[model samples]
Target: MAKVEQEAEVRYANADGLADALRGADALFVWDFLSTAVPDAWHAADRLRWLHIASAGVDPVLFPELRSSDVVLTNSRGVFDTPIAEYVLGVILAFAKDLMRSYDLQREKRWQHRETERLGGKRALVVGTGPIGRAIATTLRAAGMEVSGAGRSYRANDAHFGTVYPTDELSEHVGSADYVIAIAPLTEQTSGMFDRHVFRAMKNGARFINVGRGELAVTGDLIEALDTGQLGGAALDVFDNEPLPADSPLWTMPHVLVSPHMSGDVVGWRDSLVEIFVDNFTRWAAGEPLRNVVDKDLGYVPTGTSRV
Candidate 1:
C-alpha cells in the first residue's frame, strides 16, 4: 500500500501500542481483522477520519465508540465472496460423494465400496442474503440443487435469491431443506439464533453447515442434534470460541468436519485485501465516497450497494 501511496505516511503498531499509534493518525487500516484493539484505542483517535478493515465482516470492530463516531468505515466485502462460495461447494460435494470415508478406507488399505448420494434435486437453504450467501446459493443451484435464502426481511424477488423469507419463517423452512447453511452476520437478533428448537425442526437427515459467526450457533444444541441422529452430519468452519478448545467433543465426532475459520481465504488473500484498502484510500484522500462502506449499525455493507 505504501508503494502506491507514496505521499502518505504509514504507521504500524501491534495491539499493545495501538492506543499510542492512534494519537494523531488521519487514517487507519486495520489489517488484523480479528484484533479487538480498535475499541481500546478509539479514545486516542484525535485526527482519524477514515478506517478501513481488511475483512468483510466488521463485528470485531463494531464497538460502541466506533459505531457512534463520524469516522467512515469500509471493508473488503467483494474480496471474500467468491472464495467462500467455492469453499461451500467443495464441502457439499465432499459430503455427497462420501469423500472423507473413501479417504479413510484408502489410508487403511481396505477395499470398501459404498453408495454415495447424488447432488441433484437436493434442497439448500442459505441463511444470509449477503454477497457471500448469494454466491453460495448460485453455485449450489448450478450444481443441480434447489436453493432458497432467508434474510432479515422477506423479499419477493431478490437479484440473486429468487425468493427470500424473513427470519421469522426460518423454522418452517429448516424442516424441509436437505442442507441448512448458516452464513448470516452477528447481530443482536441473530446471536445464538440456532438452538435446540431450530435443530430439532430440521429434516431428520439434514446436514448443517456454518460459515457464519460462531456465536450464531449453540454448540451444545448442535452436539445433541448430531448425537441423537437428528442431523446426519455437520461441517463447521467457525466456532463460538476459536481454535475450538482442544477438549471440545467436536474434534472426535465421526460425522463432523472441523476446520479453522478460513472459508473466505485463498492464495493471495492478503494482497487482495491490500488492493481494496489502497483503492478505498485513494477515494478517501480525494474526498470521494469510498467503496464497501459499512452500515455500522447493521454490521454489514447494505445490499444493492455497488462495490468496486
Candidate 2:
C-alpha cells in the first residue's frame, strides 16, 4: 500500500493520522497502545474486514461497532511476553535483596552490610493465566520461586493443570504469598479487584508487581498500603492514566517505583509487530487458518495456544 498512490495516506503521525487513514481501509491495524476513545471509530469500522491490535491487550479498542462486526480481530500475543517476564523477575529480586535500599544508602556514603534475602523459596501467585502471566510464572519458577497461576477457568484438583488454579479464590492464595503479581486482564470482575481489602490481605512487606492494567490495583489503596507498611514496595509499569499525571503521589513515595510502562519496549518492536502481522496477514488473505484470532465472545481472551 505504501508504494502505490495511497503512499501519502499511509504515512502516519500518530493515532489521529492513522485513524484518518482507517476511514477507507478495508482492514485496520490498531497499533496505538494508548487507550483511544475515538467516538467515530464506527465510521471506518463499517468498512473494516479485520482489526489487529499491536498491543497484547484489546479492551481499550473494543467498541460497540467493532465488537459487533464480522471482521476478524487479533492481537500481538507473544511479542512482549519475554521482555516483560524478565523485568518482573528483576523487580522481584531487587525487592527481595533490598537492592533499592542499598543504592539509597550508598548514595549517602553510608556503609551497611545487611544480610538480605533471595528470591528463591518465595511463593508467587500470578493472578492471570494470560501469556504475560504464564511467562512471569515460568521465569519466576526458574528463579526458584514456588509459582502458581490462576485464571477464570483453572481447577485445583485437575492434576494435569499443575501450579495453576482458578481465579475465583485469588484472596486465598494471594494473602499468604511472599509476592503477589497481577497480570490480570481488565474486565468487569478485575477493574477494582485490588482495593483496600485486597491490599490488607497481602502479607506485610510483601512486594506487589503490576505490569498489567493500572486500574487492577486501586490507587488510593496502594498508597495506603505502602504508607502503612502493609506492602514492602511496588514496581508499577502501567497506570490508570498515561505519563501518570506529573503530580501523582505515587511518584514521590520512597517505597514505590513509578515507571513509564516501558517493559515491552525492544529495539525491534515495530519490526516485530509488522513481522507478526505479515505472517498472519498472508494466511488471512489466502483464506487459510488465521493465527492469534481473538475469542471475541469472551472479550479478548488469550488462550496462548498458537494456531501456528
Candidate 3:
C-alpha cells in the first residue's frame, strides 16, 4: 500500500464510509471482499473505472450494477492456490488415518489400535478446474491418489486431472470416488449444486471436503447425509453462514471437522494479497492489462487470463 499510495491518492472506507469514499473515485480496491456495502452505495460510484477484490471469489462484489458496467474487475487469484491445495491434502491424510479419533481416545485416556485407510490407491474427484483445482490435482496425484476433475465441461487427457467430467453430470460419476472435494467458485450455476441427490449418489462411507464457498453445498442436505451415514466424514472450512451459528448441529456432529474459513490463509497471506494488488495497480497506472481480470459473465477469472 505504501508503494501505491505514494503514487496515487488512496481513500480508505469501511462499510459506512464506502458511499462517501466512492463518490469521485476512479478505481476502488475492495480489501473486505465479504462486505455488501457496494450495491447499496452504487449511486455514488459516478467515475469508478476499475475494481479489484482481495479474494478469489467475486460473488459478494459482483452486484448487478457492477456486472453490467464497463469497470474492469480483478482478483487475487494465484496467491491462494498452492496454500489451499496443501491444506486439502493435509485433511485428506488426517481423515484416512483417523487422527481425530486418536485424539479423542487420547483425551479419554484410552488406548485402541485400528487399521487405517491408505491414500495411494484411493480415487478422488475434484470439482472445479481452475488454477486452484489444478494445483489440488497435482498435489493429490503426487501423494498417489487417482485424480479426476468435474468442471463446466468434459475433457480427456488433461495435464493435472486425468479426465474431467461435466459438473452437470457429477452425480453420475461420484460413486466411484473415495473422496469428493469441492473447490469451485460460487456462481448462479453453481450455488446449492451439492444437494441431497448428489450426496445420495456417492458411494456409502465416502468422505467429503469443501474449501470453496459455503453456498456451493446445501447445508441442510449435507447434515442429513452425514447423520444418515451416507458420508463417512466431512472436513469443512467454509459454511452456509460464517461463525456457523451456535445452534448448528455440525459443531457437535461425529466424524465432522469444522474450521473457520481460513483454508488458504497461511502466515504472511495478508502481505501476499497486498503485493498482488500493488502489482496490478502498477499495470493499471501504466495503461497495461491487469492480471487476474475476472470474466464477470462467468463470475471468475477465465482459463487463458494472466494467472500465476
Candidate 4:
C-alpha cells in the first residue's frame, strides 16, 4: 500500500464504492473479478488508461464499453494456471479411485470394498489449449494418462498434448476419452458447449471435469446426463448460479462433486494474484509493455503476447 501510494494516488473501491473511484483514475486494479459493478461504474472512468483484472478470466471486467475503449486490459493469466491444473488432476484422481463414494461409506460406518478405475493409460481430452489447459495436459501425461487437446484449431505434435483437435469437432471424438475436462475461456462460441449432445456423445461411464466458467456447460443438460448415466460422474468447480442454490439437485447427486469455484485457489493464492498486478503496475509506471494483455475480441490473452 505504501509503495503504491508513493507511485500515485490510490482510490480504493469495492463493488458498491466505485461511485467516484474511477473518476480521473489513470489505472484500475480489479481484484473482485466476478463483480459486475464495473459496467455500472464504467461511465465514471473518464481518464482511465489501463485496467487490470486479478484473475485469468477477464470476461467479468471486459464489458462492452471497456472493450471499445482505448484502455489496455490485462489479466493475471499465469498466476492460476498451475494451481488450476493441479486441481483438475486432483478431481481426475478422485473420480478414478471413487474416493467420494468411499468417503460417503465411511460416514455411514459401512465396510464395503469396490473396484476402482486406474488412472494410468486412461485417455483424457482437455478442452482449451491455453496455458492452464497445457499445464493440465502435461501433468496428466506425467501421471501416465494419454492426454489430447481440443482448441480453436487442430495441431500436430503439441509439446503437452500430442494431437490437438478442433473444439468444433468435439462431439465426433469426445467418446474416446475416459475423462473430458473443460477449461476454456468463456466466449460466445464456447457458452453452453457441453450440452446434452456433447454429454450424450461421451462414452458411457466416462467422467467430466469443469474448472472453467460456469456458463460453459448447460446445467440442466449436465444434470440430465448424470441422471441418465450418460456420464459416470462430474466434478464441477463452477456453476451457472454461484452459491449454487440450495435446492439444486446437483447437491445430492451421488456422482456429482460440487465445489465453490475454488479450483485455482490454493494457499497464499491472493499473494500470487497481487504479485502479477504489482509487477504489471511497475511496468505501467515505467511505460513498459504490460504482461497478460488481453485480446478483447478473442476474450483471452493470446499466446506469445506476454512480454518479459
Each model's lDDT comes to: 0.89, 0.76, 0.93, 0.90
Can you write out model 1's per-residue Cα lDDT over 196-295, one digit (the tens) per residue?
A: 9999999998999999888888999999999999999999999999889999999999789999999988999999999998888787778888898899
Model 2, range 129-200, lDDT digits (tens) per residue? 777887888888888998777678655642222556666666666777888888887776788788888788
Which candidate ranks first by lDDT, i.e. highest? 3
User: Model 1: which ten-residue window has the lowest total lDDT?
Assistant: 1-10
> How do the predictions measure up, each by TM-score?
0.97, 0.90, 0.99, 0.98
Encode model 3's per-residue lDDT on 91-187: one tens digit a residue: 9999999999999999999999999999998999999999999999999999999999999999999888989999999899999998999999899
Query: What's model 2's overall lDDT?
Result: 0.76
* For every candidate, C-alpha RMSD to the true structure in Å: 1.2, 2.8, 0.8, 1.1
Which window of 10 residues has the lowest lDDT sum in candidate 4?
299-308
Clashes of each: 0, 0, 0, 0
**Per-residue lDDT value at 9 in model 3:** 91
Winner on lDDT between 2 and 3 is 3
The digit string of per-residue lDDT tens for model 4 on 223-298 reads 9999999899999999988889999999999789999999999999898888888888888999998998999999
Q: Give the clashing residue pairs of candidate 1, or none.
A: none
User: After superposing candidate 1, which stretches have Cα over 4 Å from the reference?
Assistant: 3-5
